[model samples]
Target chain A: QTVSPKPSRLGLCAACHGETGVAVMPGAPNLAGQRLDYLRAALKHYRDGSRDVPVMRAAIGPLSDAELDAVARWYSVQIPAAAKL
Target chain B: QTVSPKPSRLGLCAACHGETGVAVMPGAPNLAGQRLDYLRAALKHYRDGSRDVPVMRAAIGPLSDAELDAVARWYSVQIPAAAKL
Candidate 1:
């Protein structure tokens, strides 16, 4: 699995989720700095239909496991925005 | 905070995500059997605008931290459907 990818290599996920994994769309979740295992599991679920969101499933459809892992790793490593209460 | 709630008490999250946290909606995610820390952190981020998904922000808007914790607990304990590859 590719453990380190440059920000430019984030690819498909960046269309909805921003380059850094914060979402640009209203319904998409921010994935920046999320836990690696959660991102990995979620990506797998999206591919396999366990998560069952049409857009997500479609987005993840053609990706191989290594690609998914690289995408998850890219997002997990980005710095998440701070929470403001 | 209520650590143990019957499925009925999953409440708001269940409206889009099903009673067991498996999403029935096209855009919603399956929260069932997600990690507790991830769920808890996500709930807080939603409330704080860190996650910034409009539907989730609105859904979590009126809830307190303790209430969020309860919701996280509810979903985290649910049985996730197996990933079908």
Candidate 2:
């Protein structure tokens, strides 16, 4: 059996969330170094409509489950700038 | 004239946001080391109903301008664990 590769569109997330998940927009939340469980759950919530932020809903709505997990895992491991201190 | 002190109720923010703003719960976005402008704007949006997250609205709705600014400033300056790297 073959496994799928992670998505390469994470730059979409970086548009507002910053290249490192620190957020470039005023309202976007920082995602770098956050708990993997929370990041995944939040993405699922946005996708499922349980958490209804318009931008987030639209952004993650089209992603597959595996893609969501991959995105979450990507942000979870990013080294937050604050951690460097 | 005497000036009022910054609110001492930041512990309330820490309940879900973590004492250090890294978030202790799933779905709670980490706040540590985030941009000060973004943090303040997010809190204000929550308070003003523009960013309609129910829990965040309730959490920050009652704070005064100074209190809100204080909270945002506090979280802004916190050293995020990821930054230590």
Candidate 3:
């Protein structure tokens, strides 16, 4: 039996990171066009507390490995602000 | 009396944030071409502990207002990765 796909976590990311992964908040980083490996590693760092960002730690803590991968993949493909209008 | 200008703190920043302000580490954000106001605000937040990033807090804590502004100015003017080939 096939499992239903989980909902995209982009909205949660967008709350601080903006629709295109360009940050809406001052401290949040633009995730757009970042390397997929970097994104995945960052998420894992937050999840494991290796990176000390309170907001990111909270946001990434509950996500599964698949969810983290999915989020990283989504942001990696977006056009970075330098390329956008 | 004329005081000598302080050296650019870009070296400290470049330790994790590359020579051009793009991140060298997996979790560090690319600071190139970020908004000047936003960069200043982020530095202030880190200095004040309003943003809970240990490395940033340590890095920003000892800096004076002028130093923070200088660092912010330095990063805000660099070209972002999206603009580079």
Number of the top-ranking candidate, with lDDT as the measure: 2
Q: Write the per-residue lDDT of candidate 2 for residues A1-85, one digit (tens) a residue.
A: 1223434778778899876677777777777787787787778767777666789988886777877787777777777763334
lDDT of 1 by residue, B1-85 (tens): 2346564346787888777665667656556555576677667766777555689898888777777787777876655432110
Steric clash pairs (candidate 1): none
lDDT (tens digit, per residue) of candidate 3 on B2-74: 2223337767888988866667887777766666776877787677776568898888767778877877777
Looking at candidate 2 chain A, the ten consecutive residues that score lowest on lDDT are: A1-10
Residue B82 of model 1 has an lDDT of 26
List candidate 2 segments past 4 Å from native: A1-7, A48-53, A82-85, B1-7, B48-55, B82-85
Q: Identify the candidate with maximal DockQ.
A: 2
| Interface root-mean-square deviation, candidate 1 | 13.2
| Docking category of candidate 2 | acceptable
- Cα lDDT tens digits, model 3, A1-85, are 1222433876778898776667888766776666677688768767776656788888876778887787777776665654334
Instruction: Write the candidate numbers in order of decreasing TM-score.
Output: 2, 3, 1
Which DockQ-derived CAPRI band holds candidate 3? incorrect
Model 1, stretches more than 4 Å misplaced? A1-66, A69-85, B1-3, B7-9, B82-85
lDDT of each: 0.65, 0.72, 0.70
Candidates' chain A TM-scores: 0.83, 0.83, 0.82
Q: By the TM-score metric, which is better: model 2 or model 3?
A: 2
